[model samples]
Target chain A: MLDKTTRVNLLYDHYGALLTEKQRSFVELHYLEDLSLGEIAIQFGVSRQAVHDHLRRAVDQLEQYEAVLGLVSRHMRRRAVKRQLAEVIAGLPVDDDQQRRLLELVGELCEDGNGTGGGDGDV
Target chain B: MLDKTTRVNLLYDHYGALLTEKQRSFVELHYLEDLSLGEIAIQFGVSRQAVHDHLRRAVDQLEQYEAVLGLVSRHMRRRAVKRQLAEVIAGLPVDDDQQRRLLELVGELCEDGNGTGGGDGDV
Candidate 1:
């Protein structure tokens, strides 16, 4: 299973804009930037409890969007399939030069990709 | 370049969750489903002016999110690059069968993909 933080990080990348500014900021700070609730509260000039609530609400909202749309889940599955295809390409009978070039081409495609390439795990 | 509707459609796909439910509903009805403004107004029991205002504000917010984060733009670029890579794969010296299989594999990867595949020609 993916850790809560990693899952939330992916969720935020996909749907963070739907969150209120305060919620987005608190989630980003707490999850992505590794800030404590107290620290985020200080930065936002709110109580720690308030920051905690904001983050939870944001997380819940993210989950709700995912439940409704399944965008993140689909993206993760597509990325996984792509990675497996990469492995299949590696196992092809093509020579080293051809394989390297093909892989390079794939990498170029990924140059502009969202950071959805690898999954340490998923929630 | 993409038409305004195309651009907004992609934007909606990426960030519609950030909008109010009403905003999301209006945009979906008008854009994806191609409902007339009058129809949407009747469906929602609102004035045409109110529907228009909601859509305009939602579009503006989508644009703002794109400006701040560039997610839709990056997705467009990435999708473009992947298409180019697919073309390159098509050109590779692999036999016809291998090429066809690779194409099929790529298509499989995209099976669970977002509907971001073709440009049809972006905004």
Candidate 2:
């Protein structure tokens, strides 16, 4: 079974794509493989602090990658908006007029046309 | 313009969602805002090495987060697979028979059906 740290590192590496190979490996072994820092150090024949240092540096790199890209933020924002829209649709009162209006709004939001504002339209 | 370190850190924080507030801010200023180590030290009222230490630790945290959660990995994998598939479709010869086969495969891949294998079908 994968250790928590390694698994999390893998996800970050995959998404961030900015980590060094050594850093990625360190994360995988320590975090996903559930190996202790000592174990990793032993296996890699490095000091425990060295392993720790690498892990720490790797995290910084991942964070740096995200801050520059903003892809994750955009994705999360879109998800939040979609979730909010879903809630609004689900909570609408059963009046025919209200239902129709909600449906229309949803359709507008989901439309492929370029006329809608307040969206990240194609640049 | 955001510094390199700060921008990179923001992306990671937004995606990773595992960093401490201090770590995020440090990353934002250093990486995205392009502040120097010495500058950041003065601004944060910490030693240069202290800022470095914070940035390093923050990276470790972000990597640890990714290791535990495979969301980033999954997203990358999906992107890779999609890119490969797109390349294959784009490179196909103009033969009608091949076109039909390719279209069929694409349709199957895109279908919201339960029978297809080789996909991360909903569990």
Candidate 3:
């Protein structure tokens, strides 16, 4: 049986792109809907191992797609930076000048890529 | 030295929230900007091991966050489903009735989780 964490990760990695209609149904029933593999197998009229194999293959394909495209990677990075900026903003002492400067920096970082116009140098 | 795959995965998992400013900077320079660990260490005036440790800790934190909260997992699943839908649409033959039904189903799935109101049943 796949652990919840692994199943969730696999879904995250490929839920929209890598699965077929049948495979997608399998994963949704098994993971998001919290159905057992055996139940899914019964529903789909397949063996438990077949369901497991489909999920495994789907995850491998999704990982491969991510390896090539990197959209998920970029999104994750932006999220991390945003979270860090929020923390910084929240933790600042009550200095108006410092707060203004920090907020400006945060805005700059949060802006769309072209706004800064630096070639990764500022980073 | 971190493999590119693991580094990328780490960034995706925890890029914005879990890393400190310094840790975020280190990962960006190393992964996004393609800087070497030794170079980053030299620039930050720290040992290579320190950089490595920061990255390792950051990755661990990101993984922990994902384990607990699961935003990344949800995003990944949505992406995979979208990809599969695209493929199915592309591969279908030029039959109007089937095409119309498929398109409708696609629209429903792509909807913002409210319109059809079907629970895990539709899957």
Candidate 4:
């Protein structure tokens, strides 16, 4: 299993825009900016416990979004499949135009997969 | 653009379980069961307008979910990529064990992609 921070970061990447402004700020500050809970509390003019509670709730909401939508897990699996495909293409003995074309297609698949899935935006 | 029925069906497949019971029932009755709005409203002891309103909200919610998550778009693109890969694999000159294995992997990717993204479940 991924560590909590890593997992939350992954979830945040997929569902951050869905969060409210305060929740999004807390996540970005605490996780991406590496702010301590106390520091975030000071920045937001709230109690440390309040900040902690808000962060916990925001993280739970992110996990819930992942549970329902599952974009993160699907993206990861697609990436693994693409990697495997590249490996197989590399091992092919034929060095003809078709082989090169296959390689190019694999390259495009990797890039296209990332382009489609890496961010939270309408496509 | 997909026809409205086709688009709603696709979105429903991806996000049906997230909907309320009433919304799910109306959509299933009208779209999946081919029941008209009046038929569904009569069965539920409500006005046809009420049924229409519920279905419209439900479909809008499903589209909202898709707009944020983009799972339907990703699934479609992935299917297209898999088909292209299969075509290239079929045209390859090599007729060896490796070719067979590559074909199997492509098949597995197709199956695995569907298994992961076709329904709503926590994987």
Best by lDDT: 4
**Ten residues in a row with the worst lDDT in model 4 chain A?**
A114-123
Better of 3 and 4 by DockQ: 4
- Would candidate 2 be rated incorrect, acceptable, medium or high by CAPRI criteria? incorrect
TM-score of 3: 0.35
Q: In CAPRI terms, where does candidate 1 land?
A: incorrect
Highest DockQ: give the candidate number: 4
> Over the stretch A1-123, how does candidate 2's per-residue lDDT look in tens digits?
545454455346334334555776787676667789999999899999999999987776555544443333433444455455455445543455644554453333322111112222111
Q: Rank the candidates by lDDT, best first.
A: 4, 1, 3, 2
Q: State the C-alpha RMSD over the true interface residues for candidate 1, after superposing those residues.
A: 8.9
Predicted candidate 1 versus true structure: per-residue lDDT over B41-89, tens digit per residue: 9998999999999899889877876665465766766567668668877
Instruction: Report the error of model 1 at residue B56, Å.
Output: 1.9
Model 4 accuracy (lDDT, Cα)? 0.72
Q: What TM-score should be assigned to candidate 1?
A: 0.68
TM accuracy, model 2: 0.34
What does the lDDT read for residue A60 in candidate 1? 88
**In DockQ, how does model 1 score against the reference complex?**
0.21
Tens digits of per-residue lDDT, candidate 3, B45-77, equal 999999999877766655544454343444445
lDDT per residue (tens digit) for residues B1-123 in model 4: 888888888788777766766787898889888999999988999999999999999998888767766657866775787679778887777777877887776554544222223334332
Chain B TM (all candidates):
0.75, 0.55, 0.60, 0.80
